[model samples]
Target: MVGSGFQRLRKSPWEILSSAIFSSILVVSSQLALAMVPHFFPSFSLVSMLPIAGVVFVATVVIGRWCRRLLGVPASAPAFVLFNVFFLWGVYICIIRQAVPSLLDAILNAECALLLFGLYRIFSSDPGMVSYDSSRSTEASCNGFSDFSQCENSSLFPRVRYCTSCKTNIRGFDHHCPALGNCIGQKNHRLFMVLLTGFVIAESSYTMCSTRYITRFLNTSRVGLEANLSLNMVISTMLFSILQVLWQVVFLMWHLYCICFNIKTEEWINWRKYPEFQLNIPAPAQQGSAFSEIRFFNPYDKGFVGNIKEFLKPKH
Candidate 1:
């Protein structure tokens, strides 16, 4: 079943009993952690956890709603709460209690929550879907369409191609993210970029805060509960921080380059694979020449400042 992820009881009864025993042992070990090693540093209060906890709950609920609509799967809510919100919350809690000061964690996580809400905006909005007639008119020149083809509509919408997967014409269609269960398109591309930027900022803060604790625990001469817990939290948070920071930084840079050129990932890929592919809006049909002559040059190139303005400005 789709949501019945782990219901199978295939383990033998002996295996089950052994697993239970082992779990009990692990629990006892964890409880004894502070006792066995008094030097270990982390001490938490419900107060510290509260702010981040509230953020996590709000993120889970908001993203759950947006993600379900994007993916068209209402049944994913349980997993969304379990993995996206609480799982991350658990990791975050480790950092708040063991690695970073609670006040700092709360501040950083609040910013992270705002970014998540921005991402939810991207996920929930349409990706600038163009009408079929609008796309079809690209063959002719009319109004601002300088391309050879005639354009009957002067309303001037982005020239879009048909998307077989979506069964619609999409303006500036990027590609479908299976994880998001939605296509990245013109409308939300900028917001998506900002979301990635947010993750980078948040993860960087987490890694930095974790580093001091990790250094102290690793350097300690004595081995005890605090060292072990600190080690676990530091290692876990740092690995992801390194990965996310690198990936998001690179991804954001590449996308910015694309934005400067007014292209999407899908368009870039197509242009690379196919020699005849065009990168910009259709060229003016001109007094004589067809729009195809300068294939690499972007028709939408409004210089860096203009592009930035258009990109940052909100659209209806």
Candidate 2:
């Protein structure tokens, strides 16, 4: 007998349960950490989490709205953003106190959210095929034709091209993401990069501050009422300063290389792009490349040694 008025769930019950369980665990762990940790550790604060929470909530809402739009549903970005902000602020106050580590954790959490969102987008998208349709060309007489003729026709899934894992077409293709998920093609590319940049800045700043604090802590000496700054602090500070300088120089060089070459992270994974996309752009990849064109670099790529070589490679 056919069951009337019964609809099959689009998402599995176990999947929903797992998601809820994971979210609960994240909240509980964060709350416990905040409660147990000393207030001195900056990560225990509401202020530290605010920015990250805001970014995560906003990005999630934006992606949801985008999905709805694609499904022919009406949605407003402003309303979603506003709602997310309010909810995020509430979570910030309820979960953690203002502290540096807390702030860093918030940023990390936001990055995780973005990564998950990107992954979801990649899986949900349709796989598009690459093909050529010369019949549609209105040009009567083509004085010139090149090897690029095969790229004349757009892929069936115009937003996505090569999927690295499956080595096939990706639906709703945005771009490839290594940090969050596999790729950020069509759907979640914008949100992924936006959150990623924010995460990088937040993480870097936190690391810098923590290193300084650790140096100061190590340098402190137990002295009588007349306490003087120890030489150890001075040495630690000098070492940290040099390390920081070197880190920044390396980072800036890599950024410059990406900008000049017009390469996206996805290109590294699959070496695919639209026929119209060009590799000779002057602006940095992060700053100039469209959301769909940017790619994420793998951090575990030969421990900075290989990275330097890759960054210095000429754009061809």
Candidate 3:
């Protein structure tokens, strides 16, 4: 049943629309968020904003459009970067001003970073034009002959096929990334993972650092530093927390689906098979167990949830 639903989603127009809308929101919101950074952090010189904002904007536009063109999908790397930077900036402000961030700030920052990282993974590692080569080596034996089967001795390197879009025989070809506007074959996969890891680390560090400040605020009885618990503050924090959790769940499921089925984002997006071969191809291999795959810096890992248990487990 789950497989059937996934197959349906693969072909759905709604997914494309959702991807586009989400990407646009990410682009616009990221720009707005970047703009707000200056207002929030008055101490920072305007020059600092230009470099970060410029890199973020260019990366966002390129990635977003690339995803759309390659997979008929859209994503907002800019928004993810914006939220992360600003959220950290907010924490930095709280720390600088009061020497401690409130519990509210810490909670908000941590949650925001987690949410942003999840979104970034979903968009960034979207497997724009990548797919498995069913005809190459896993032929005959692994073709969809049985349910819940595995491929045996599949060829890692196969003959190249010309990509209509790129007009080149891509080596170690996984798929083309519209976001990066390049093929994410073997050579570039590591780079993509590195980009994601950096973003996650930066966002998480900012959140945790701010959280320390928040704890300090909680411990103090300083005259004006106590949280006022105003209606607006309470409501915003609550809503943000709820949204963060919800997004986290969505991300978790998506990651699990990808890992279990071994489907690349690109393959999932542009899944197609020659008419003669469609019925014979078996489903792709599922990777490692969910628990094992989620660890930090796993070569094949795509999102933070793969290591959720490790992340959530209390440190000794």
Error of 2 at 150 (Å): 11
Q: Which ten residues in a row have the lowest lDDT in candidate 2?
A: 138-147
Q: TM-score winner between 1 and 2, please give it.
A: 1
Whole-model Cα lDDT of every candidate shown, in order: 0.53, 0.39, 0.42
* Off by more than 4 A, model 2: 1-10, 26-160, 164-182, 186-190, 203-259, 270-316
Q: What lDDT is reached at residue 85 by model 3?
A: 48
Worst 10 residues of 3 by lDDT: 1-10
By lDDT, the better pick of 2 and 3 is: 3
Instruction: Give me candidate 2's TM-score against the actual structure.
Output: 0.31
Superposed by TM-score, candidate 2 places the C-alpha of residue 86 at a distance from the truth, in angstroms, of: 13
lDDT of 2 by residue, 35-117 (tens): 22222233434345434434443454455445555654433222222233233333333332132366565764565466345
lDDT of 3 by residue, 1-316 (tens): 1121111013257655666466556645545444444445445543454455455545665665665678655443344444434544553554322543477456545655654555455444422232444443445554642211122332332322334445443333445544444455434444454444544444444434534544564477443422532211222222232333344456445644554544444445543421111233334357433332211122333355644443233322
Which tens-of-lDDT digit does each residue in 202-276 have in candidate 1?
778766766666666657654886556656544544544555576579888988987776666775665543233
Top candidate on lDDT is 1
CA RMSD of all predictions: 14.0, 17.7, 16.2
What's the CA RMSD of model 2 in angstroms? 17.7
How do all models score by TM-score? 0.57, 0.31, 0.34
